[model samples]
Target: MPSPVGHALGGAIAAVLIAPRGTPTGSGSRLMALRARLSHPLVRLGALAGCLPDADFLWGRHNMETHSVGAALAAALVAGLALRSRRAALVTGLAWLTHVAFDWLGSDDTPPLGVMALWPFDDRFVFAHAYLFEAISRRYWLPNFVTHNAWAVTSEVLMLAPILAVLVWWRQRGAGPRV
Candidate 1:
């Protein structure tokens, strides 16, 4: 939600994974095509627009659902409806979900009320906000919303492999049309 890293990671995964599912014969090609579509200024603007509102409009106390999952889904759904691409919808959903998932693990609070991460299907929202960012001194506050948690250290040391792998696979699999 803060840096868009989680959203980008999730979008990449969903795009690559869904590409193959949508067109089994041309999985890579579909991925590339979708990537191109996603990269468009219109699509990027749309995604950012969807994501930025919560950060801009919402108040403090960590609006997890609106900031992460809710916003992402709203963006994806809008983009999907506007573009008429189910794949686009899928990718956007994944992006939003990914943002939520990351926050869940990084913190200790449960999700906010009525988050509806899987809206129209699931009614529950996650509300975990345990991570609190401190400066390098571990005493002072950072400029923006950077949280410090035990899991942050763990995430840096151990969990990075799978995350990196997923990222690498997403980008590589989504690149170029195969002959």
Candidate 2:
């Protein structure tokens, strides 16, 4: 499964694409606009949501209940009620689901491999077996731990940076206007 870094990037991307936008104001250079979007509370919340499913680790259940559509919907409902914005709710829920997506596409080295993505409706675990992202290691004492994780993080950055750049460019070119 992807690390928090990758998951956060995915969530931020979802937020940028789906969250409702305010009217563009001031100097609308790409950098400024991108900065503004990145700094929005919704983006930050999305990033948080992206990493939220990992909280299952605290209970020694990393890919169980929290990594499910049910959890995503609950998160959306709570965010919607709290923010009073349907767009925010949708963005937040999708952002949370991005965690599940990353995990589904990643390599899983643990037992009962894959995530319980459809929980509440079904308890079956699922995985794409795509291996698009590397599995993260919790074994700090392993010889290649640091090196492996570093490479994993680098790979994630390389994969995600281009997409983020394109999205920012599209927004700047008015192809994706703030809505």
lDDT per residue for candidate 2 within 42-86, as digits (tens), equals 778888888899999889988999999999999999989999988
Candidate 1 weakest lDDT stretch, 10 residues = 130-139
lDDT of 1 by residue, 1-179 (tens): 22343334344444444443222233367556455545544335424443343363346534434545556768778868987987667656665565555444443323353233544454465544544211112334654324553434434434333653454355445443221
What are the Cα lDDT values of the candidates? 0.46, 0.86
- Candidate topping lDDT: 2
Q: Report how far residue 151 has shifted in candidate 1, in Å.
A: 11
Error of 1 at 77 (Å): 2.1
